[model samples]
Target: MSVKPEPVSALFAGSFALATLSAPDGPQFPALVTPDARVTDLRVALADEALTVRGLLEDWAATLPRLRALAAEDGPRRPLAEFRVHAPVEPRQVFQSGANYRQHVIDLHVAHRAPDDDRPEEERRAEAAEIMDRRAAEDLPYVFIGLPSAITGPYDDVVLPAWAEKPDWELELAAVVGRPAYRVSVEEALEYVAGYTIANDLTDRATVFRRDMPQIGTDWLRSKNAPGFTPLGPWIVPAESIADPGDLRVTLKLNGETMQDESTKDMIFNVARMVSYASRTARLLPGDLVLTGSPAGNGMHWGRLLRDGDVMEGSVTGLGTQRTRCVAEDAS
Candidate 1:
């Protein structure tokens, strides 16, 4: 029996915005994709030279269709593999969710409970579940800010600072905001999203807490904002393509071994709810990133802290994959 070849679909049908290095230690340009899956280098792809991916995201609704139409027309095309891909967009503001995954938070609570308090595991789990249920009912989402300077390309090398003894990985799905949102309702939240990308929110586990100030909570700046700490994106998959952001699978492999394997369905607060919660206090502008929390099976849970020469591959269904290699910070 003969099998039929799958029909070739338009490249923009599930389109992504990508950047490529134009020269060694030089400027990057928007990558133009063709209908046949080939990429073309063209200045016309971007109207403004000063506008980075962040600016493009502001007009994503109009920009996407234009690029798609351009791709359908004749143009100089190159093989997609020939170019180096950078993070899809440079976010002006980055909002990271903490303990938003049901299983992940429960795992953390159970693992960190005091040794003397030997409550039954089942009871502890039930209590954690109750807390999540309460939080969902109360409409609360824990969000923290991250610096944009820490952003790096998906395949960039992550330099583990010498002071950081326990570098860890948290793979997450990041929503890219297209419109300015302030106090948006949950029913209208997803409409403000331009697209989605993958971010590996690398953390220094040893520096997560404040040693001097026990009253203060997590020191996110010290723990999560090192240079190149956040390895983001192979591309931005337009939100329209993702029918349900909550149903996607988030997977990570450390040194070729499966580490984190879970679905966004496990999230305590879904994307819409999280976005709505974030906008309640902050003005979410175009190109701002809202990172939904990581799922269960982080490095802390597995006791497999990142080391020099270790590689981590993270992917979200349809969003694309990011592979980052770890290297020790050069003190010289």
Candidate 2:
């Protein structure tokens, strides 16, 4: 049977669900959207082996409108609840910003100061503010690469490795690249964005710092790239749909208690700067994910790290909610 065609309204719509439908044939389609209002089933709006979803993202300006229009058409529909939601797109490159949130970095500086320094809280705040101002004025964004294998579905279960002692959650707003960006200016950065999504950048706090190699500092690979460490998606809201990425709120809850609640307005570099900074050194292709960093209120700040059977609910204003459960890795 042929997939149903999407409606024209879907093309102009600001939000759409690009999902993988579970079929006996296996996971099918990378760009399927719900054409009807009920979202019972998804229709194949765009499918190409070579370009994939990443290529479609390169021309998102044209592709999104087409997809939105397709979504308006009445074609084949599937039961939305029966299929599992994958990371909206399979990114060829993933760039995550580090210490890019104003309040978050400041909080770390204050909390991790030398015990003997004995600086007052006000002084620490002032110092941190000065440092941030200098970085913003002279320095570029700090970005690191992430393994795509670490990605999991929005509602997937996160397996806490037996070796990880302090699992933590970082709710962030992730931008989906729609066009090629290389050495682009900050003023033109947002033009490369296709849409936005939510990601929970789970971390193993205990492994963040290498005690043996203090000079080397952070060990992001070991601390942040475990399987199912990045829980992403639910939906990708078109960039046009988001009036202001900088103003959105990022909230996370541990189990049933609210843990992290902050706004993107606290970002030290903002999305445009982060994207432009990343493109300066690396060629950003369509479908590449650029995480804008998490705000303050991470588990490290609360001293309440994640444990087995813990649940994490992360949400961004326009993006969507992601619910993940933490389970202990099975010891063989």
Candidate 3:
């Protein structure tokens, strides 16, 4: 089987982003990624030989302007296509929003209706909509902690455990925190964001619910925290570049078939609310990710779950696109 690599620039527009990359013969390093697929190693650009994306994020206020200046000037650069891409940042914390998208939650409720449920589809949808409206009006966002170890490179392969009967795709928009935020207000939440990236939060439906201890709630640990479960970023597009994070399109395709394609407008709690809510209890540090939650059109909705050799391609408008092939791991 011959593999032809896709040009990294084709996945994004004419803008600048921060990414982690390595040449076929060199070590991985943070870089200034150009929409034309050229990369300027941040070490050389910043005059810091040991620079990392996390470190850049920690000093994002000072780093961003420098990155911008570098983006506009000529420097020693190599075609990004010649390098291996890695997850842009190795975050210390990951906060995941659950059922935050109105249509997404509604779709799940309707799709997972019990066998005894004989309600008309329209009635079920309407009921779900009402519940969503109530959830929207309510003050809090449903947020959960996720392990950073689960994160993988944007172009890496996802190993689906053989025991995972119903692995699914959930493409989401994740905000990258640049400033330390604690109990921040919704009006000021975006101020703490450095930028945004694409995240594909894969899940194992079979392991989601604990049949014996239903009261304990969804087992997110086993369902979502598997290694390589969260594929994040070819790069992080600066927040200043995106006009409105709330209006971007989140799209995912399976084997070239469009599966999840929804606007952030469908979100019950917007990015600000989600970020503010997350900061209320936990200290959101630099490089921490606040996943805004996945939109509708999961594998469960179409009854076509992930299989070995399936390819998932996802993107958040202007952020960039990520492609990952699925491989079934031997469970035994």
Alpha carbon lDDT of each predicted model: 0.81, 0.78, 0.90
Which order, best to worst by TM-score? 3, 1, 2
Query: Ten consecutive residues with minimal summed lDDT in candidate 3?
Result: 1-10
TM-score of each: 0.90, 0.88, 0.95
Per-residue accuracy of model 2 over 1-332 as CA lDDT, tens digit each:
11122223332234465553444555544555452323423233443444445556767777777777766666665655445556678888899988988888988888888979888999998999999989888888889999889998888788999989899898899998989899999999999988888988889988999989989999999999999899887666778878999999899988779988998998889999999999999999888999988888888788888888888888788665778888999766
Residue clash pairs of candidate 1 = none
Considering TM-score, which of the candidate structures 1 and 3 is the better prediction for this target?
3
lDDT (tens digit, per residue) of candidate 3 on 125-213: 99999999988997589999899999999989999987788999999999999999999999999999999999998999999998789
Off by over 4 Å in 2: 1-15, 23-25, 31-43, 46-52, 74-76
Best by TM-score: 3
Stretch of 10 with least lDDT, candidate 2: 1-10
Best by lDDT: 3
- Candidate 1 whole-model C-alpha lDDT, 0 to 1: 0.81
Q: Considering TM-score, which of the candidate structures 1 and 2 is the better prediction for this target? A: 1
Off by over 4 Å in 1: 1-26, 34-37, 46-48
Instruction: Please tell me which model should have the higher lDDT, number 2 or number 3.
Output: 3
Candidate 2: residue 79 lDDT (0-100): 53
